[model samples]
Target: DLQQQALDSLVQHLADHHNAEALGVLCDVADAAAVERAMALTVERFGGIDVLVNNAGITHRSSFADTELAVFQRIMAVNYFGALHCTKAALPSLIARSGQIIVLSSLSGFAPLLYRSAYNSSKHALHGLFETLRYELKGSGVNVMLVCPGFTATDLRKNALVGDGSVAAQPPLAMGKVASPQDVAEAIYHGALKRRRLLVLSNVDWRARVLARFFPRLFERVLLPRLSGLKPQRAGRF
Candidate 1:
């Protein structure tokens, strides 16, 4: 079923998305060797890498106290190190083409999300790493862009791991309006084309920025739970 889903997504992309030449490979991004192989295959298929979008990520929903070290490590490997591997593997081609690296981070990267310490930490690391890379490669022509999209319509929560590292069976509680995948894609497309440094999609992401900037303590105590599905009573524990 997993393989079928992957193949279906590929088939659908081939059917309705890019031209007949777009390719998809089912490689684990967390594996550095697999990432390198994927890059090699991409070069063989596409001739060169022009734009690299590191969108693969995983999430875990549990209190920090309940989260195990393995859970934290697994999340970091996917969300942070996965990007690192792909970027490193594709750097040569990217630099040669003056390409762009697009990172699909979350609002949690900048603003903490309750019960998602590992996820938050991973995204924050991505921001720091890529932002620094932007300056380091300033004259190299390779541009880096980090996208922070708020909660969107996706099966992310369904695939998220629980406290015991099992797949979350039920969807999380809905917070507010959710953005469609198509909408988020369009924003990313335009932002990448323009070589923008940061793409903050949706008002929810903007609200995270506003809260983090304007009201630090109040944001932590007040709005974080609202965004994170954390009940008000257990604020101090996490």
Candidate 2:
């Protein structure tokens, strides 16, 4: 976590409530060296990793034409390369333990959303990368699970960056009924327990995927207006 206090609170909560021995390592996933050190510490503390969850990500809200190139690079660095780094660092331990890799992706990974080109591309890249890894790792006893959750109530929107790399002035519109983080977590837990390859968390996202896949024009006609309405009111050019 970026904030050590949040990490410590979570660690303490896990210990107090779940009786789970947890270690909090303050490291930025975007930094390869930091991720390596974090992985080393985890392996040192726990002997080996059974599950590696690539959940670190950031989102941006801006039209592709107006977004600064640096914005896209920053998003990709954290959302895609961050996951890549952690996976690489933990692969040996995971392989040794026949462990699982859980990636917290989004419905946007497969389905398109307005003003999030960078975020969408990063998640798409994740699906491509990990799916291939899964195929290559077949019979290797390492499971890679990709989870696609719909609009969940989380700080992601509050922390979303704009084209100028500042915190967004407005929250991005939700396409469907907002999901609770608890519900999403429950689904992820069950999905991981079953070693499922793909876990789509919400019916809204499932329907959107189907619509986007089978009826692209209709999907656009229906979704575009809603998304367009949510576009930030500020000037597009940064």
Candidate 3:
């Protein structure tokens, strides 16, 4: 988490409710050095790493024309580079233990979404990077799982960045049934246990993935209407 207080709260909750031993290390995933330090501390505390979950992410809600270049950079820093940093720092420990790397990508990773160019591109990059890494680590026993979850009920939407980097005034419209974080977590846990390569949570996201891959034209026609309400008022420069 970005906030130490929230991290502490979560740690306490896990300890109290789940009787789980969890160390809350406050480190921003975008910062490579911080990630390294956090990973080192975890390895030191736990003796070795068994699983590394790259779930850090952020989103932006702005048309490409309205969005400043810095906004794209910021979003990429948190969503893409953040995962890259954690993966790099934890790779050696993961490899040593023949561990698993679970990446939390989104349906937008493959399918496009309106006014979310930065977010979509970052998730797409994760697929390209991690999927390739999976093949490279085939004999290493380090499983790489990519999780694509559809619209989940989270504060991510409320905290979405706008064109100028401010929080988005309005969250994007929900196209299908929104999933709960708990349901997504359960799916991820099962996927990891089975060492599944790709886990697309939710029926809606699964349909989107199929449509986007097999019928691009039809996907555009179907998805465009659901996302049309999200189009920015300002005319796109392109």
What TM-score, over all chains together, does every model reach? Answer: 0.91, 0.93, 0.93
lDDT-superior candidate, 1 or 2: 2
**Model 2 whole-model lDDT (C-alpha atoms):** 0.88
Q: After the best TM-score superposition of candidate 1, give how far the Cα of residue 44 lies from its true spot, in angstroms.
A: 1.4
Q: What is the per-residue lDDT of model 2 for residues 78-147, given as tens digits with 9 covering 90 to 100?
A: 9999999999999999999999999999877887888899999999999999999999999989999999
On residues 2-108, what C-alpha lDDT tens digit does candidate 1 reach at each position?
26477678868887866675666778888999899989999998899999999888898888999988999999999999999999999999999999999999888
Tell how far residue 52 is off in model 1, in angstroms.
0.3
**Which candidate achieves the best lDDT against the true structure?**
2
Error of 3 at 97 (Å): 0.8
Which 10-residue span in candidate 2 carries the lowest summed lDDT?
229-238
lDDT for residue 91 in candidate 1, whole number 0-100: 96
- Which stretch of 10 consecutive residues in model 1 shows the poorest summed lDDT? 229-238
lDDT for model 3 comes to 0.87
Error of 1 at 5 (Å): 4.9
Candidate rank order under lDDT: 2, 3, 1
